[model samples]
Target: MLVAAAVCPCPPLLVPDVAAGAAPELDTARAACTDALGVLAASLPDRLLVVGPAGQSGRGPHPEGTRGSFRGFGVDLDVRLGTGNAGPAATERELPPSLAVASWLLERTGWCQAPVEGLGVGEPLAAERCIAVGREIGGRPERVALLVMGDAGACRTLKAPGYLDERAAGFDADIARALGSADVAALKALDAELAYELKVSGRAPWQVLAGAAENADLAGTLLYEDAPYGVGYVVAAWS
Candidate 1:
């Protein structure tokens, strides 16, 4: 059953090496992520599953020890899913960008309280399917915790990745409220078309979270919320 969860944005920029001089801008977000991981550790879950958005090449399950790197982003840093054992085959499948970011966070926090694994959900995955996947995760026999990584809208400003959109602010506000309160219905009800247009990669993953927490009865706290690069990045913890 679901025991705890931490939601975070998955931008590679969260890594100091990737952000370089601009890394200070995300210090608070990084701190919040650290605090959220502490909550997950306190839950004492038997396992930790990191879920994130991915494209075709990166989709599917990634066992513990699956490798990820920031080389593509001009950094030499690499991370593994967990310190647990994973056969050589595990390293053959690379993690998606979002999961790589999660791996970075786990390494940064020195997470060793639980065995870890990863799943990469597609951005275009239907909400129903996403929920189904989440239900399967939440229904696992072992106590499970999740580190969900994905970004909200990317069109907050004219210079944003998706460029400015009139509806971006309202969309991000609703997402913030839902995540802050752990409102499953709201998350499940998110409009996919609108989200797609707004370049919201978190929609599918957040819905999956909604499905997972359906019976967990968790209370939530919004740890951070911002659009530093005009991309909506939010951090929330549920326990």
Candidate 2:
């Protein structure tokens, strides 16, 4: 069953190496993510599942030691899902970028309390399907903790990735509230069509979280919220 969860943004810039000279811009958000992960560790879950957006449907079950790299982002850094075990061989597929960011976060925090795993939910997955996958994850007999990573709208400002959009602020505001209050219904009701138009990649994974927390009585805390590069990035914790 779900015992705890941490919501984070999956921007490659979260990695200092990837961000390079601009790394300082995200220091606060990075710190908040660290604190959020600490909360998950405090819950003492039997397992930790890192959920994030991926390129295609049914993209992962990235087991422990699965590898990820940031070479494409102009950094030659590599990360593994967990500390021990020899991961996938050269012939095996590597994790998607979202999962790679997740792996980086785990490594930054030195995660060691539970066995870590990764699940990549397709960006365009329907709410029903995402929720179903989440329910299955929550149904596990052992306590499960989640680290969900994805970005909100990237059209908040004129300089944003998606450029200025009048509706971006409202959409991000609603998401912040739902996550801060642990409102499952609000998350389930998120409009996928609108999200797609706004470039909100977090929709599917957040809905998955809504499903997992459906039966749990969780209290939430909004740790961070910002549009540093005009892309909405939020960090929250539920326990």
Per-structure clash totals for the candidates: 0, 0
Name the regions of candidate 1 deviating beyond 4 angstroms.
Answer: none
Candidate 1 local lDDT, 1-239, one digit each (tens): 99999999999999999999999999999999999999999999999999999999888899998999999999999888999777886878889999999999999999999999999999999999999999998889999999999899999999999999999999999999999999999999999999999999999999999999988999999999999999999999999
List the candidates' TM-scores in order: 0.98, 0.97
Model 2, residue 131: displacement in angstroms? 0.6
- For TM-score, the strongest prediction is 1
Angstrom error of the Cα, residue 187, model 1: value is 0.6
| All models, RMSD in angstroms | 0.7, 1.4
Tens digits of per-residue lDDT, candidate 2, 1-239, equal 99999999999999999999999999999999999999999999999999999996328678888788999898999998877685544226688898899889999999999998888888889999999988998889999999999899999999999999999999999999999888989999999999999999999999999999988889999999999999999999999
lDDT per model vs. reference: 0.94, 0.91
